[model samples]
Target: MTLLRDLPLSALRALAAAARTGSLTRAADELGVTPGAVGHQLRQLEDRLGVKLVSREGNGIALTRIAEAALPDIDRGFDALASGLRRLRFERRADTFTIAADPSFSSLWLAPRLDRVRAALGRLDVRIVLSIALDSMLEEGIDLAISYRKSSARDLASADLFTERVIPACAPALIGSRSDRDGAGMLDRLPLLHIDQTMGDDVYPTWGNWFTAAGGQRKNIDHGSRFPLTVLAAQAAISGMGALLASELVLREHFRSGQLIEIAREVPALTIRRRLVWPVDGPKARHAAAVAAALAATAIAEADGPWPTKS
Candidate 1:
């Protein structure tokens, strides 16, 4: 067993270079050292090993039988070292910014608006991971998170992006001329879309809650199909499958395109707060700040616009 402490790296490098090139001058040129230095290093290595590793052959050198036997192992060791260094450099230079978000908010709200973020931070790579688990951000190396939590961890920095208001919405074709009826009566005639509490959050809104808020009975609230994701409920509403209770922020595009109509706007709004969260101390903090600023601007823009009203 040879101790690594006995082998100097400089001597090993010189020996390997000289063995491959077969010339002290060429090895020195490759190593950016003088030919005398290369020769001295090779001699030191031979003395340490107690073996004559090279012999003078014409203008160059030839490896001795013992040196030839060791050459393959030395070459392989250097190649592996070089490969490991390259991988480390590549990993550090990737420059990708990752965000964790709720699936519904990502698909309906943030996904469409990401082009604006890209344009604002040109050349910065952005990745959005949609999940119901807010804790996934911390576990998965996410640089930032769009969270519905009222507070964040002590080690994290957070900015209020926007607050969401839950409201009833349905496809324009589902309404017909029934818009003149009372809120509860109109709600009673339509199948009510419900969002299931599959995200492990006990405080999520329900059709019954919306019905109670609108001064209606809970009879029809539990009759419609249930969906795990709010985006799926919104899509169901767009296809005229049923009327869905969704955040105003998520339904803005649907309203603007006339794909869905806001119903029962007179009902009191249920507010849900959203925030942009990131670690307070990390390599990605600066990049997260820029992304948070862009997201904040988009949120403000959305808030300043007029709420869609029925014509």
Candidate 2:
């Protein structure tokens, strides 16, 4: 009896490839090995089986009657093996908790704090999908989602992460001194950085709205280069491209590093609440819950104090 344990998987793979392609060179290419290696594997398989599985017919090789009889079963066995491996790989991927959030939130807020969250979650893989569209977490295979708006879905569980305070900020070089303007006048003289409203939901506060809150004329706020994302606007501000109205939490690192400075005059900062949401009952509910907890803890820590001052 040919013991299954004695059958080498590599030899079988080589035989299957050669049988499927009908050429040693083609099989070698597919297997990413030399033709000689493929031939050696075939020889070893045939030697063990004690049968002539393939014979060289003229310039090419042909499978013998014995090989023809067994090829179908060999192919079926490899197919089953491949299917099993694919399933295992997919299951392993599913173990990773996938989160979806706004592009700016993912890049600026979540990414910087990922190390701490990862340390807390130990052995769990976290995947972040940055997008503006609010997709169904269950249907999209997402473990959790962070959104500016609260989820209205009946099947989802939600938690408040943090409320963002939006403020006017600019590169240190952009401001001459505290006397640059009495208050909101500085914005009119300098280029006002605006976040492009079309990229995300209309709920995003605008430079015009901020100006109005600061008791500045709306006409002075409307003119400036527009950025599609908050991160982009923050980058422009850091580069001294213009003065940007941005979230204090999102640009905390920049403020701490002195790359960007908040304007002295305080406007009524826009307050937007961020929420963590997940399907109430799903395959990854436990994993999502763990991730959500880590995120909430991190959010609280961040809200408690500013980022560490870096020289």
Candidate 3:
């Protein structure tokens, strides 16, 4: 309630730590200070507030009723201050990278390659935000965005990572029940689960598009069920809700495992390329390049076949 500038922040922090841990020594250890230093701060804080903050016993300390009541508010204030400082420090760190990506790309592609990234770049801190909002990356805070794009945008310094390719997918049970061997022909009988883009910023790659690309017709294009994300649509397919036009990058392992059947591998290619994009002249550009290289290499290796097979 008082003016923040008038409060002794360091002493309040020490009081909060001591109240939380119930011991000056433990709190001191956490703060990287000596027990005596912690005690001095606590004493200073109590003197400033004109209250006995802690009751000292044999080896431990207990907060007084007044201390207990005031500590929650004090701790909350300290926590908010600490969080702000952390964000400031993170923003200042030149090596720390933040990436904005689609949910499917984050889960299917980048997440699998994180180990390779860690091994290549020692202890690099990456903050991955699930988004297709390119505007967020152009803002001050976001460093880069790895996204599925049909072409490069003028605002972004972009490099191609990999193409977004789709294959017909359904649960193993659904595939087994079908009489046809070719996946494309089965679309007429089965419902096609659609993944509608929630933001309307990204276009949904559909079975009809793939079918037409592969020299088939969209006469049997089914739009029985819809989901917001490809991952959710794939899950619905896996549960036998309907067939899904899913990315090969995402469905590779599932297809090999027999969890989901690839209705047709030779279907038309509705491929979209992934791009590592950032503001043309920003500090994040180099970091985005490094990440793009690492991610591209991973995607290439995975796309080589010998994918995860049914055990």
Best by TM-score: 2
State which candidate, 1 or 3, has the greater TM-score: 1
Q: Residue by residue across 154-196, what tens digits does model 3's lDDT show?
A: 6667677777666777887776534463555777677789877
Candidate 2's TM-score reads 0.63
Alpha-carbon error at 88 in model 1, in Å? 8.5
The positional error of residue 277 in candidate 3, measured at the CA in angstroms, is 1.3
* Clash number for each model: 0, 0, 2
Better of 1 and 2 by lDDT: 1
How many Å off is the CA of 159 in candidate 1?
A: 1.3
Question: Candidate 1 vs candidate 3: which has greater lDDT?
Answer: 1
Name every residue pair that clashes in candidate 2. Answer: none
Error of model 2, residue 46, in angstroms: 44
For model 2, residues 1-311, the per-residue Cα lDDT tens digits are 36596768888888888887889999999999999999999898888889988889765588999988988998899899889987786687666877787778788778787776675455768888754344456656777888776667788888999888777888888878666623666877778888875412467677767767877665655778888888898988899898888778778888888898777464556777778888888666776777788889888876667553422
Model 1: how far residue 308 lies from native, Å: 2.6
Candidate 1: residue 159 lDDT (0-100): 92
Top lDDT prediction, candidate number: 1
